[model samples]
Target: MVRFGVIGTNWITESFIAAGRKVKDFELTAVYSRKLEKAEEFASKHKAVHTFTDIEQMAKSKEIDAAYIASPNALHAEQAKILMQHGVHVLCEKPLASNVAEVKDLIETAKQHDVLLMEAMKSTFLPNFQEVKKHLGKIGTVRRYVAQLCQYSSRYDAYRQGTILNAFNPELSNGATMDIGIYCLYPLAALFGKPKEIKASGTLLESGVDGQATITLTYEEMEAVVYYSKITSSTLPSEIQGEDATIMIDHIGHFEDVKIQYHDSTEKIISGPQDNDHRMFYEIEEFVNLIQSGKRESSINTHELALTVAEIMEKARIQFGLIYPADRLQ
Candidate 1:
C-alpha cells in the first residue's frame, strides 16, 4: 500500500480521508495544516498519527510516500514543486497552476527530479466518464458540445457585501475558470484535443474577479461552449450533441451517472456508487499506483491538456479584461 499525506485542513481534506478509507491500495498517513491544532484535529479524525504545521517538513519526511495538495490555487505550483523536489509524489488539486507558464515550470521540475506529479482532476478518472468515451461513437459524429458548471458560491453573499473570501478573491488566483470552468475544459480536451481557435468572454465582479464566463472553442467541424458561474446556478446538465445522439452528464464536473439519448431511445450509464464520502477516491488510487509502480506519467496524460485549458483561460481573461495579478505571468 502507498502512504499519503494530505495538505490543508479544509473540508475537502475530510473527503480525501474518507475516500482513502474506501480504496484498498492507499492509506492516509499524515495531515498538515498551518496550525498545530488544526493538524491535530484532522489527524484525530482520520486516525493519522503524523501531523505537521510545516508543509516542508512533511514533504521531506519518510512517513509519507506522497502528498495530496488540497491547498489554495495560487499555492499549488510552489507546494507541488517542493514535494516533487523532496522525492515525494504529488497529486495536486486541479487547474494545476494559476497559468500555463507555471504549469510548464512544474512539469519541467517533475521531469528534472524524476518524480511523479499529477493534477487531481477527479472527474476524468471515474468509470462514468470512461463510459462516456465508450459511447462517444454511439453519439454519432460530434457537432457541438456544451458544458455548464454554474453553482452559486456558498460565500457569494459575503462577497457581494465586499467581504472578499478566497473563492471570490483574484489575489488567490480564484475565479470561474479555475474554480468551475476547468471541469468543462477537462472533459472537452479529453474528448476533443485542442481546438483550432478560441473566443471567450466573462462578467467581471466588482472585486475584479470573474463571477461568470463563457468559453467558445472553434474546431474544424464542431464547436464547443463552456459556461461556468459562481454568481448563479444552472439546471442544464452538460451534454454532447452529434448528428444522431446526445450524451448527458448529470453533474457538471464530478463522476456519477449519465443518460444518453439517441433519437427516441435513452440509455442509463451509472459509474460510481451513490456514496457521499468523497469523490477523491478514484484519483487517489491512481496516484498511489503511479507512485508505487514508478510510472510517473498519469494514465490520463492531462498535463498537456491542463496547459491547453490554461491558454484558453488566459485568452478568456484578456477578452473580458478580467486580469488577475497572476495572469500577469502570461
Candidate 2:
C-alpha cells in the first residue's frame, strides 16, 4: 500500500481521508498542521498513524511515500517545491500554483528530482466527465459552451462584519475564479484546447478581490462563456449547445450526471454513476496508482491542461487586476 500524508486539516482533507478509506491501495499514514494541538486532533479523528507540525520533517519521514497538499493557493508552489526536494511525490490541490512561473518551477523541480507531481483535479478523473466528453459530439458541431458555478460563501457574512477570512483575502489567493472558475476552465481546456483570444472581466470587492466574474474565450468555430461567483449561487444548469443537439451538465465541475437531447427531441442519451462519496474518490484512486507505479507524469490526464488553465487564469488576473503577491513571478 502507498502511504499518504496530508498537509492541511481543512474541509478537503476530511474528504481525502474518507475517500482514502475506500481505496485499498492507499493508507492514511500522516497528517500535518501548523499547530501541534490541531495536528494531534486531526490525527486522532482520522486514525492517522502520525502527525506533525513541521512539514519539512514530515516530508522527509519514512512513514509516507507521497504527500497530499491541501494548503492555501499561495502556499501550494512553495510547499510542493519542498516536498519534491525531499524526495516525496506530491498531489497538490487545484490551481496547482498561483501563476504560470510557479507551475513551471514545480514541474521542473519534479522532473529534476524524478518524483511525481500531479494537480488534484477531481472532476477530470470522474467517469461522468469522461462520459460527457465521449458523447459531446452527439451534441452536433459544438458551437458554444456555457458553464456557471456560484455559491455564496458562508464566510462572506463574517467578512462583511469586519472579520477577514481567507476566502475574501487576495493574500491567500482565494477568490471566486480560483476557487470555482478553475472548474470551468479545466473542462474547457480539456475539450476545446486553449482559446485563440480571451476576455475576462469581474466585479471586485473593496477588499481587492473578485466576488463574481464572467470570462469569454474565443476559438476557431466556438466560444465559451464561463461565469463564477462566491457572492451568490446559480440556478441555471450548465449546457453545451450545438447545431445538432445539446448536452446539459448537472454541475460544471462536479458533473455527476449528463443528459443529451437532440434538436428534434427524438434522440436522447443519459449516462453517469450514482455513487457520490463527495466526488473525490476518483482523484484518490489516480494518486495511488501513480505512486505505486513510479510514474513521473499522469497517464489518465496530462499536465498540458493544467498548464493551459494556469495560463488562462493568469491572463484573467492581469485583465481584472486581481493580483496576488504570488503573481510577482509573472
Candidate 3:
C-alpha cells in the first residue's frame, strides 16, 4: 500500500480521504493540523495511525510515503516543499502555487529531492475528461474554446455582512480566479498549449480580489475565453468549437457530461456515466502509480502545464490589479 498523510482538516480534505479509500493501495497513515485536538479528531475519524500538530514533524516522521496538501492557497508550496525535502511524495491541490515563481521552485524542489510531485487536479484525471481529449479530433480544426464556472460562495453571505472570510481574503491568496477560474484555465492549457496573447477583465471586490473575471486568450488561429465567478451562478456549459463540430462539457471543473454536436445537426455523447462523488479516485490512483513507477511528475498534469496556468493567472491578476500578499514574497 502507498501510505498517505494529509494536511488540512477541511471539507476538501475529507472528500479526498473518502475518495482515497476507494483506491486499493491507498492508506491514510497520518493527519496533520495546526492544533493537536483537531489533528487527533481528524485522525480518529479517518482511522489514521498518527496525528501531527507540526507539519515538519509529520514530514520527518517517515510514517508516510506521500502526502496530500489541501491547505490554504498560500501554504501549498511551502507545505509541499517541506514534504518533498524529506523524501515524501506530494499531491498538492491546485493552482499549485500563488505565482509562477513558486510553482517553478516547487517543481525544482521535488526534482532535488527525487520525489513525486503532482498537482491534484482531479478533473483532468477523470475518465470523462480523458474521453474528451480522445474525441477532440472529431471536432475538426478547433476555432474557439469557451469554458466557465460561477458558483455563489457559501462564505459570500458572511462577507456581505462585513465579515471577511478566508475565501475572499487576499492575504490567503483566495479569489475567484485562483479558486474557480483555474478550473477553466487548466483544462484549456492541457488541451492547447500556452496562448500567444491574453486579455483579462474582472470585478475586484472591496477586499482586493476578483469577484468575477473574463479572460480571452489569443492563439495563432483560434481564441479561447474563460469566465469564472464566486459571487454568482452560471448554468451555461463550456464549449470547444471547431470547423466540423463542437464539444460541450457539462461542468468544466468536474466534467460530468461531454457531448459533440456536428454541423449536420448530429449529436453524440462522448463520455460515459460517471460517479461524480468518487471522481477523485482517478487522481489518487494516478499518484500512487506514479510513485510506484518511480516517476517524478505526472504526464498529464505536467509541471510545464502547471507553470503555463500560473503564468496565465499572474497576467490576469495584473490585468485586474489584484495582488495577494504571497505575490510580494520571495
Tens-place lDDT per residue, model 2, 1-330, is 888899999998999888878887888889899999999999999889899898899988888889999999989999999989999999999979888889989999999999998898888888888888888877778999999998889999997899879988898888988999999889888898999999999988888789999999999999899999998988778988888888888888778667887767874556556447767788778878877877888865567778999999989877988898877656
Each model's total of backbone clashes: 0, 0, 0
Local accuracy of candidate 1 as per-residue lDDT tens digits, 1-330? 788899887877778777878877787889988889988988998888899887789888889988888898988988899888888888888878888888999989989999888888888877788888888888788999999988999899998787999998888888888888889888898889889988988999888789999989999889999998999998778889989888888786765668778787866564556443466777877777777787878868457877777788777787888777776765
Q: For each candidate, C-alpha RMSD in Å?
A: 1.8, 1.3, 0.8
lDDT score, candidate 2: 0.87
The model with the greatest lDDT is 3
Give lDDT for model 1.
0.84
Q: Model 3: per-residue lDDT, tens digit, 1-330?
A: 999999999999999999999998999999999999999999999899899988899999989999999999999989999999999999999879999889999999999999999998889898999999999988889999999999999899999999999999998898999999999999999999999999999999999889999999999879999999999998999999999999999999888889999888889998897769888899999999988888888899999999999999999988989988898886
Clashes of 1: 0
Best by TM-score: 3
In the predicted model 3, the residue pairs found to clash are: none
The per-residue C-alpha lDDT of model 2 at residue 241 equals 87
